[model samples]
Structure formats: C-alpha cells, structure tokens
Target: MNTVPWLTILLIVPAAGAVVVAALPRRHATLAKQLTLAITLAVLVLAVLATFAYDPDKAGFQFGQSYDWISTFGISYSVGADGISLVLMLLAALLVPVVVLSSWDEVDGGGAGGGRIPAPTATPDATGGTPGGSAGGPGPAGDVGEIGAAGEIGGVGGVGGIGGVGGGSGGTAVALAAPAPAPARPATVPPVETRGEAETHGRRSVPAFFALLLALEAGMIGVFAATDVFLFYVFFEAMLIPMYFLIGSYGPVTEQAQRSYAAVKFLVYSLLGGLLMLAAVIGLYVVSADNLGHGTFDFATLRQMEITPGVQKLLFLGFFVAFAIKAPLFPFHTWLPDAGAQSPTGGAVLLVGVLDKVGTFGLIRYCIPLFPDAADYFAPMVLGLAVVGIFYGALLAIGQRDMKRLVAYTSLAHFGFIALGLFAFTSQAGTGAVLYMVNHGLSTGLLFLVVGFLVTRRGTRDVGAYGGLAKVTPVLAGVFLIAGLSSLALPGTNSFVSEFLVLVGTFTANKPLAIVATCGIVLAAVYVLYLYQRTMTGPVVHEENRVLHDLGLREKIVVAPMVALIVALGVYPKPLLDIIRPTVTATYADIGKSDPAPTHPAAAHPGAAHPGAAHPGAAHPGATHPVATQPGGHS
Candidate 1:
C-alpha cells in the first residue's frame, strides 16, 4: 500500500491557494494571477509525479488514503486514483494554467473607458432632423440617451438632455442634443476584454475571478480523487458555487441580466440533478443497512454488496439521472449552450472541457459497477438517447450562428459518442470512451481558447462577423482550423483515434446502432468545415477583419502545447491506451461481461482434414478429438 496521501495533498494545495489568492490586496491583481498560475503548475507537476508512481499492473485503486468521518452515518474522508481518475486530474491541471495564461489580459482595467468603447454618437438625418429620429419627430422608440463619460446613461428630457425628440425643425441645429461625455474608467475594476482588445472592454474584479478559478480547480480535483460516495457527492455539488459565480460575474455579455439568467439556469438544472442523486444516496444507505447489517458510504464496500434488482433499478435512476444531466445528455442539455455562450473564455474551457466529463465519469465509476443489473436493464434506452443526441447535437451545431454556442452543441454530440461506447459493454469500447474524455478536453478546450482569442480581437461571437480572417491572422486561423479539424475527427488528429475506436468497438456489439451512429461523423464534418470556411476563408468583407493581428507570443504559447498533443496522440496513442485499457477491462468485468467473439468467416486451408473427424491411423480409444483451427486459434 502506498503511504503518501497524494490525492489529499492535491486537493489541499488548490483549496489553500484559492484562500491565499483571495486574501491578496485588490491592487495585487497581478500577483494573485501569477500566484494562481504557479499553484496550478505545481498541481500539474504533482499530477505528473503521481502518474509516474502509478502501477498499471496493480489490481485495484492505488495511492489510496482513508480516514473516518461522520462514522454514525458511515461516512469517511477517503481519496484515491485509478487510471481514469488520474488522467482526468492531469487534464484539469494542464488546462487551468493554459486558461490563466490565455486570459492574462482578459481583465486588466485600462485604456479608454477601461477597455470599453464609448457610446457612439448618433448621426443626424439628411434633413438635419433630431439625431436617430425623423425631422421634428420623436427619436426612434426606446432609444436611450448617450452614455456619459462615467459609464452612466444620460436621462431623456432631463436638465442635461432633450426629450426623445430633439425639439428642432427640419434643417435646423439642435443645441441641446450634444453627445454625452465619455465615461471615466475605474482603476480597480478592469474590463473583461481578451488579450489584444484590452483597450475597449468592461471591468471585472480580477482577484475575485482568479480566486473563484482556483476554488473551482480544487472542487474538480476532489470529485475525481474522492473514494467515498457521499464525499464524491459533496465535491460534486460544491463545485457548482464557483462555476456559478464565474459564469455570472465574468461572462462576455455586457448585460449583467443575461449573465445572471444563464448562471441561474445552470444552477437550477444542476441542483435538480443533485437533489435526485442525494435521494438515491440516502436510498443506497438504507439498502446497505439492510444487506450489510450497517449503512456505509464507502464505494468499494458498497460495490461488494448485492442489492435486489428492483431497488438497484430505482437507485440507478437517481444517480444516472444526475450524471445524465451533468453529461447534459440530449434533453437535459439545454442549459449548456447558454452557459457556454455566456461564460468568459477561460471559464468556458473548464466548463465544457473538464467539468462535463464528471457526468460520464460517474456513469462508469458509480452507476455501472454499483448497479450492474440496472445498467444492463437501461442499456437499450440509453443507447437510443445516445444515437439521437449524436444527430440532434450535430444538426444544431451546423445551424448555430454564435461561435461559442456552436462549440457547446458539438460537445453534446461528442458526449453521445462517449455514451454509446460506454454502454456497448466491451473493453475496447470502454477504453475508447475514457480516451475520448481526455481527447475531447484537449481538442474542444483548444477550440474554446482560440475562439476566445478571436472574440477578444473582434469583440463579438457572431459567425457572420468574420470573413477571410486568415488574410490577416494566419496563425490564429491555423490554430482554429486545427482545432476544428480535430473536432470533426479528421484522420490525423487526436479525436479521430478515439472516435474510430468507439465506432469499431460499438460495431462489434451492435452493428446496426454503430452504423447509424457513424452518420454523426458526416454531420460533424459539415459543421466543423463549414464553420472554418465561413470564418477563415473568402474575401475580407469587413474592414475591421483586415487589420486583425495574428496570434502574439503569449497566445502562441497557449495553443502550441495543445496543438502538439493533438497531433502526437493522433499518430501514436499506445501510451494512453496502455494506461487506460486495464481499468476499462476491469470495469467491464465488474458487470459480468467480456468482449464478444468476432463472427467473421475464415477461409479453410486446402487439403486440411476436417477437425472433428478422426485423423487416419490416429484415432484410438480415449483419444481426444482435435478441434478445427481458425484465425486466432478460436473454434
């Protein structure tokens, strides 16, 4: 048994770092950010070290530590990492630093209006009528007065301004209609602009943002490292708080109400799922009490108990529903689009990349092993949902106008592929599903980061706003194209390998379903390539796009590692496969299933004797009959 409490240390470092960073003086925003980055890097180094120390040949969970807590209710503070948990921990660690570096200038308060654009001056009509209205008529309905220099809107028809109508005759000058002075930028609140567009954005609290980010990291790590079921649930629900604030406080939308609405919606959906899981957890304890003579929340111990089929089904739905919502599978997925579109770039990366994986991970970790019979019982329904999601999400992705929403939709489809593989119940499919989780994080995380870079430069997420960006920002375009290609599972990119494995494995188990799921690949191609063509090719129709600069040094640093990993994994996935396959095999074994033997026909060798027939002069009393030789030595 390993003596070091590696998982506990991993959890504490980030939790403690968040507290420290949050306590820093407001003026030390830079220091807070730097410290946060250093802490994330440290976590990454530790994760790497833990990876090295792991023994894949071992039979069960490694680096495990357990201590009693809440003994009356059979709860404990236990932590450990299997292969699946370890890789995910590494992914979260790797992406946090990248997010921080990419968002370095995202919240620096400086420049005109603290990086926000001054309100545009209204243009007068040809007849010199009131600005933004017909001559001698009321200004366009619902038009507010110009924003003042201090970022406040001037009141209409007040002491300092005229009414909706300019009170001027045709071809006459309106003396009272002077434009409002520009707003003064606040020193402490920096605008939430991307790196290059720091000159024109609104201010958000930097220290608060980083602090929330660190807190989120702690929660994510905890969820994966946790060994106690109740503890897992605790970490699962607790992570939502930081993400709620991150989305509500730092979203790119200038309107606070919109951000708040998205945040609320996300919280509501997650909380509902959490409630279901909580009930199931209580149900599980009751069942354990009856079966084991006492209620306990230990995951391994619970896995050893055999519950009746009916109770297993009921408990399964509770946990499965929660994970599905987290997975945001099909109908449960409505909140993700809004959340992803509204969140800031870094927030979006973690939201979709690492956070959503918790759902699928739960399905593998808690749902299947603990309720094997129920998992099998619900397999058909889940498979149907997975196939539907593949088509539905892909079609919507193709139709989306907003860049971030489009990416969000694509994840919905990718999760479908993951779900399909997991339920297929073969080691190959299960391994592919876990690998897909890691690869999706890298590919889609990179996509969100690059899109964020574009949004920073252009200050918009509309797909229509860009045309021939490659003309000016070739490097950015290149990265975007790579990310897009990987998303579509282009043959040479990382997603392709995992996606291919998923299909092949699914094919072995359910040929018809696998065939139908394959069409999602075509739809994926349409959305990914069309998005690239529309945004990066053609004439530079908008002049604003002409002057956009390519990726700067910091931005290049952000993308290079991701791009390298995508290509490297695409070409050779053996290392990850080696780490992932054993756990996948064991996971499937837990449910009493194994890989199905292939049914393809094999050619008979010329002049070979039929095996069941006794060989000439070789048959004798009590002699064993020789078996027919086939490919792989299977009869």
Candidate 2:
C-alpha cells in the first residue's frame, strides 16, 4: 500500500514523458504528439485511481511518503494530500488532457483569431493571408466589427460578435446599461486570412509544444502534493521554466507585437515573487536552527515551533507577498492580462487555470498554518484587498477587448472572492474558498478553451470582428454560453455552490466584508452576460463570420468533460464537499478559528415571547413553547 508510491508516480510519469518527447526526433512530431497525449492521459488515469486510495475520514495528510533528499540541508522529499490539496490535485489531473486535446488543431495554425506566442514566422498572408493587412494594422477587406454591449468596442474590449445569442439588434443591445449608442457596424477587424478548415501548416512543431505542456503538468502536480516547505519551493520555482518557453514560443500570431515582452514580464514577476519567498524560506530555516537545534523545512516540523508574533508577521509578509503576487491580487495583477492576451490557448489554460492557483494554495497550506497569529492580525486588511479586487477585476473584464484578457481579468475578480473566504477565518468560508479554487479552475478553463476555438476560426481575438457567431457556429456558441453561465456562478453551475458557501461563511465571520463581496456576483453577471451577448448574439455583422466552421469533434471532446463536471458538481457537490470539509475543519484548527453558528432571530431576542406559546400544542417549526416561564424563558 504505502510501498506503492502513488504520488511519486504521478510526479514522475509526466516528467519522464517530457524527457522522452524532447528526445524524440523532430521529424516525427506527429508521433511525439501522440506519445505525449498517451503519457498525459496515463497520468490523469493514475491521479483518478489515486483518488480512490485517499481516505476522506483522515483529517490529516494521507498516503504520506518521505525520503531524505538533502539531509545536510535538512531537506526531504515529502508528498501527501489532504481534502483541500486533493481537490486541487484532481483539478490539475483533469485539465492537462483537456488542454492537450483543445490544442491539437490550434497549434497546427487553425482558427485562432490571435493570442499566441509566435511559432516560426509565416508570411503576412501566412500571418493574416490578406494582402494589405499588416500585423497591427487593419486588413483591407476582412469584416472588422465591434464587440461589447456599450456603444462601440472602444470603452470595453473588442467583444463585437453578437446580437445572435438572444440579444436582438434594437433595444437588447443597450440592455446591459449601455450609456452609449451602438455603432452601425463593428470596427475594422484586421483582414487576417484564416487558413481553410482542412489546413495543417504547423504540424512540425507539435512535439516540442506538447513536451513543454507535459513538463508544466509535472510541475503543477508536484507543487500541490509537496508536504515539505523546501520541496514545495523547489516545485514552485521549477514550474516557471516550462511556462516561460510556452509563452515565448508556440504562441498566437499577434500582428506586430512580440510575445517576448509578455513572456519576459511573466518571468520577471514570477522570479520577483520567488525571490521574496526564498528569503522567507531562509529566514524560516535560520529560526528553526536557532531554536529547534536543527534547521528543517518540513511543514510539520516548522509548525511545531512557536514563532514570535513579530517574527511571524515578518515571515508572513515575505511569504504572503510572494503568494499575493502569484495570486496576482489586484495591484500585482498587471502581468496576467499581458500573458493571457499574448500566450497561446493551451499555455494560457494551464497558466490561468492551474498554475496561478499555487498562490492561493500556498497561503492556506503554508502561510496561515505556519503563522496563524499573523494571518489573524492581517485578516481585515487582506479582506479589504480581496473585496477591492473583486469589484476592480469585474469592471476591468467588462472593458477588455481581447477575449483572453477579459477572461484573465475575470479571474482576478474570482481570486478576490477566494482570498476573502480563506482570510475570513470560518470553516464554511475556508471550505468554500478551497472549493472556489477548484470550481474557478474548471469554469474559467472552459471559458478560455472556448475563446481559443473562436480565435482559431476568426484568426483574430477581437470580439467586434465576430457578429452573429452563434448563427454560424451553434455548438460553439452554446458552449460559450454554458461556460459564461458557469463563470457568472449561475444557480445550476458548480461555481454557484462555492460562491454561495463563501458568502454565507464569510457572513457569519465578517458580515460587512461579506456584504461588500456579494456585489462581485452582480458585476460577474453583468460582465459575463455582456461578453456572451456581444460575441454570440445579434445579427451576423460580418459576412465572413457566416462561413466559419462549428466546434469540431476534437474541440467537443475537449470541452465535454469540463461541462459535465460544471453541471454535475452544481447539482450535487457533496462528493467534493465531503472531501473538502474535513481538511478545511483541520485548517480551521491550524489557524485557531471556529465555524460561527448562523444567527437566529429567536436567539437574538431571548426576551421575546416564543410564538409556540400562543399555540402550545399546535404544529410549529421548532415544536416548542415557553412552558417553563410562558415567555420563552425556559432557563
């Protein structure tokens, strides 16, 4: 059982596959892609099987394994999962295959409008395929349109592909509180000639692209499963390399803008965060050495020592800032939009969906538990930032031009909600926070993946260029709608459950913050629906949009599982909730907080007469009356 080393296998499988793919001959790219697929799928399978091996009843780490990796440094290779980590781990395992499938055609230069790092240079026509269409300039003949509900696509980002998804041309266009008038037509979309549907131009580089994907997967899994602080830092830092390459190469054809800037920006931000964390790590080690007689980076060992409040706060900032930047919380969120906008769909998928979550995860799994006093002390300030991020991100999303960037901004808002729940210091809120991370990954991943599909067809990421896309691509539009609905946390979608729990849980602990955070949901609805309406609804503004293909078999295969999970988790979240609740309760104990009881009117007014007193023997909700005192004063 314990001898099986399941977690180790999960880490090694994809990592080993990456090496194998890298070694394969470049000419055999198709074969490399196949091999990479098989390997990723295998890892996904193992992660699933590993789930069965997990015990929900175990409130502490499960399937624990440790080995002395660097004994002199007091470092060890320790790996395990609890309810919180398990859900996130499963989310990672689930997304990799889907990401692979979604990218199958995209990498080959299919219908992406724009949002890639540059593969090898294709000609202008090869780039856009239109004679006059320069990289950043407008195309001569292509139907450039406007996207977004308000007036033109100027204020909001280019979301112009709508009036087809149920937003009719007349009044519906202005329904989302558009203070401006709808322009007669979409703005000029660059005339990038889309390669016909059957095209397969970039097949040669498939292997290299997929190899990087596998590497990223391995890093993601390792980061979440890591139990030792030093080991966690290793994986945390290791993931950046693959992502850097993914962003630098194999990206969308932005007209003239180079993905190099985005890639470098992402790297610098990440490295800065890592440096901060490394300092904290060294500090933690030194403290342990001075007090415990040995320096150790084991999460368990670190928690055993009682750090002073001052030192805890200082260490907490070092770690918190690292996680915050990684979380890309409001002020630190500048890099994400650029990365999301410039990186290719597959790269963006892992980048936004799974990779960024490392920030939030670290806060819960490391920072708070290791520095409970600091976590409690900074709770109010953190909660304020979370609320501000929620509103701020949604507003920015509502104004984005690129679909990728819009989705990216929305994540900023969602992350705010997740952070709020975690810092609120209640079991329900914290559990909801963990659940939100899982659900956000799924829902947002779906959104990004669908946007990738549209970009593929249009050869442009401009929303305005697409009008009545639903008419031409029904299934694609439907998928977009569902994904959008999920993003808005619709009642029947998985996001709703988590959002509700966070708000409810936060309400019990911090009513004012919870109330303010609730506004995020409303803004979420506005931006989500507006994006969908602008892109998928209305009349077909562009004749070019009319001929685009619908979601292909591969694309459907990519999206189906995510959609299933969204609805399935929405209907009944117990399985996930069951796995999450115990670990969350444990986290509560780690941070020294209790789940506050929901306020009751009766409890609030002990002096009031119990209604049952007037109907002592009648049917009642509580079925009790103040028989002892006749005024609900039983005591």
Candidate 3:
C-alpha cells in the first residue's frame, strides 16, 4: 500500500482552488487572481515532484489510490498514472500556471474596467460628474474575446458584432461608438443611475472566465487520471460541460458562431460515443457477473475476465467510436479545424495539445488489450486510415488562409503519424507514439500561444494579413519562426525526434504506409515555410504594424519553458522512450495471448495429433487436466 495518495491530492487541490476563486467577493478580485495563481503554481510543483517521485523501474500503476464510493454497484473513487498518463498530467499542470499568469492583469483589473474589460466605463451622476475622477479607459488590450476577434468582423461575425468606429478619436472614439443604447434620462432620476450599476456588475463577472478555465483544467486532469472503466466514462462526459462554457461565454465574438457550432458538434459526437461505450461497459459487467462470479467495472478486474472473441469485437467497437470521435481521426475529424480556428488560443492549446492525446491514449491503454483479436483484425484498416489522415491533413493545411486553422490541420497530420505508429504494434512505434503526445503538447501549445500573441498585435488571424513581421517585432517573429520549425519537425526540435522514430518504426511494420507518410513530412515543410513566408518574410504590410512592440516580458516568460523543452527533448529523447518501452512491452504481452486458433483440426493442433509427442498435460499442472497450447484441441 502506497501511503501517500499524491494523485488524489493533485486533483482535489485544483478543484478546491477553482471553488475558492469562483466564490471570492468582487471587491477582492486581486486576491482571487493571486490565490488562483498560487494554487496553479502549487499544482505545477506537485506534478513535477510526482514526476521525480515516480518509480519508472516499477512495473504498473504507481501512486495508486482507491476508495469505494458505491461498493454495492462496484463503483469507487480511483486515480492512478502510468508513464503515458504521467506525461500528459505533467503537461496539464505545466500549462495551467502559464495560462493563469498570462491573463492575470485582465482577470484582476480595477473597477474602471481596463485591461480585458471590453466595455469598460466610468459612470457619471445627474450633473454628469465622473463618479471616480479620471478612471483611465481599458488600454490597447481589450477583453480577450474582443481582442481575439480584431479585424474579422465582416466575414467572421456578419458585420453585426463590430461596432462602428469614429475615426481619429482613439480609444474614446471606439468606446463612444459602441452599439449599446443611450440611457433614458429623467428630470428626477440621474442618468448615472441607469448605466453605472450595469457597468459595475459587468466588471465583477470577469473572474468567471478564469473560473471556467480552471474548471476545465480540473475535468481534463480527471479524465487523464481515471482508473476504473465506469469512472473513466464519467469523467469523459463531464469535460464537455466546462469546455462548452469556455467557448460560449468567454470566446471571441468574430468566431462566435463557428465556436458555438463546433462545441455542439463535439457534444453530440462525444455523447453518442459515450452512450455506446456505456452499453458495452454494462454488457461486459453482465458477462463478468455470469462467468467470473461477480460483476466489476474496475479496469484491472475487467482485464482478467475471459470475454468471447465476438463479444470483444462488439465491446471494442463501442470504445473505438468514443476514442475516434475524441481523436477526430481522418473522416471523423471534421470538428477539429473549426474548433481550433475559432477557440481562444488557450482553449485551442489544451484542445490540440492535451485533449486530443486522450483519444490515441485510449487506443493503447484500453482498446488493444481489451479486444486483442479485434485489434489484429482491424490493424490494416486502422493503419490505412492513419496514413490517409497524414496526407489529407497536410494537403488541406497547405491551402489554409486562417493561421489558426493551418496550425490545427497540421496537428491532424501529426496525430495521423502518431496513430499509425500506435497500431503498427511494433514496440518502437508504440514508444514513439507515446513520446509524440508529450512533444506535440509542447510544440503545438507553443505555436498556438505565439500565434495568439501575433494576432493580438496584428488584429487579425489572416496569414496574408501579416508580412515582414520580423522587421517590426524581431523577438516575436523569432519565437514564431522557432515554433513553426518545431511544428515542421525540423532537426533538433522535439517533434523531429518523435516523428522520426514513428516513421522508422512504422516503416519496419508497414513499408508502403510509412513511405506515404514521409510525403506528409515534405508537405509539412512546404506549408510551414509557406506560412512563415506569408507572415514574416515579405515587405511590411500596413503602417499600423511599423511600431508594434516585440514579445513582452510576460509573453517571453510564458513561452521560454516550452521552447526549452522542445529543444531538450529533440536533442535527447532516450529518457522518455526508456520509460515507455517496458509498459508497451507488457501491454502487448497481455494481449498477445488472444491470438485466434485455426479451424481445421490437423492445422489447429499440429503437435497434439503427432505420434511420439509428449502429453500436453506435462506442460501445465494448474490448467484443468491438460489445456491445449495448440489451437482447437481440448486438454
């Protein structure tokens, strides 16, 4: 018994922090921001310690914690991590503090509504006197939603969302031109009475955005950490709620429709998958109850139950639907580009970086072991789809005008390689797929953050809208360039190492598929360089860009760690591969026992019917009499 339940503490602390922030008084906004920052930083430190404390030499789930919550129903509160889960968990923890601090000024602003308050105002009384003298308007940094939308109003929002600007009036002009109606003046009642309270209330609600994001973090971590099958399903469905709110409430106005549509699509797809998996889980429990003597939803217990081959296929399909929808694999991946393009960069970072890994992770952790026969039967088709996704995603990314969507599509291509490596069933491929998860999070997350910062400065997500940005903001352009190169898997970047391993292992398993996938790498270079050319290499576009500042101190801080990780992992990836190899080997061994037998008697039990062969009973004493290692023969 491991006395310290570090995993549980890791989860509970964040949930508690979110609750504290959500309940904080409006007057204590600064305190709320600081407290939330402190909590997120604390979680990050623990996650690091958890990584250090993790005994890679140990065989299975370490830091295991379990408690029966509904024993009668075979349900329990459980959390644990293997190498894969630990890596993803650490990524989540690492990003949370950065996200919090990046938005600190916005979420913790004074009552004047500056710094991310879109509709900031200072109210006046009956005499038109300022309630608080000279409350400066929100600076160039508007609300995240407002700033993210920038210049896409006509095409993105159908022109309704962009309030007209009175030229040459600066911030005050834009503020005065807002679409809201003027206050109804009364001789007896002051005009300030009408607008002041409304404005104040709006300012107080900014913290809710942070609360929503924190809640999303909690749900995402739980999904990665869940141990029991039913518990996993529960956390799986719970994630959509917070993500739904994150997009619908705090999301950018220009992409509002696209964001809402993507969220609903995600919800519907995920729900259908969940329901199918739920049915399969129940069916498995019923079969276990009949044969294994009692029902249980514990993954470990379920793993040992001897399910029939046909039944395993059905169960596998149910789980595959859920994971595929989450993975957004090839044909099922339509929702990703839209969501990634429309979501705030934070949302997109987590979406592409961490959340997508859950899908591929499920294939390794659950599907293959739980239904080995089906996995073997379906291997070729899965491999084909992975190859298809690679070429298809890269080809589409080459045509993208929206910078964010281009990044999203590139991820699709990257995931395609990962999926291919995984189902290839080679140990090296599997290890590479696992490592790809961590590397993708680092590289893609950095790319999205850097892109968001550029969009903030340029006021557009259009790749063509930017040019010669390196000349204007050298530091930012350099960060963007490095991030793009990492995305392209250039030599000495983390993605390069993982992707190379995947291609190498995949080639060993499926030569033609690997060859086709190599084409995707070429396409990656084309689009990455093309994107950089469009955004950073040409003549400077509008005069507005001439004086744009370079990467700010906080922005640099947010990105530096990710850059270091990418470079470090690229230079030396052996440590991650070493940790993953043992587990991958064990998983394959567990499932390798499910290989099917031949139908013909002579072929099925070739050794059994041969003359002078030793009795099969001599091989296994525990098996009833003599269980046949040979196919289609009774012991």
Candidate 2 lDDT tens digits, 87-163: 88889888998888777656654433333322223223211221211112111122122222321111111233221
Give the TM-scores of the predictions, in the order they appear: 0.84, 0.82, 0.80
Please report the candidate that would top TM-score against the real structure: 1
Q: lDDT (0-100) at residue 416 of candidate 2?
A: 97
Count clashing residue pairs per candidate.
13, 42, 0
**Highest-scoring model, lDDT:** 1
User: What C-alpha lDDT, on a 0 to 100 scale, does residue 561 get in candidate 1?
Assistant: 89
* List of clashing residue pairs for candidate 3: none
Ranking by TM-score: 1, 2, 3
Answer with 1 or 3, whichever has the higher lDDT: 1
> Which 10 residues in a row give candidate 2 its minimum summed lDDT?
626-635
In model 1, which runs have C-alpha deviations exceeding 4 angstroms? 109-202, 601-635
Candidate no. 1 TM-score? 0.84
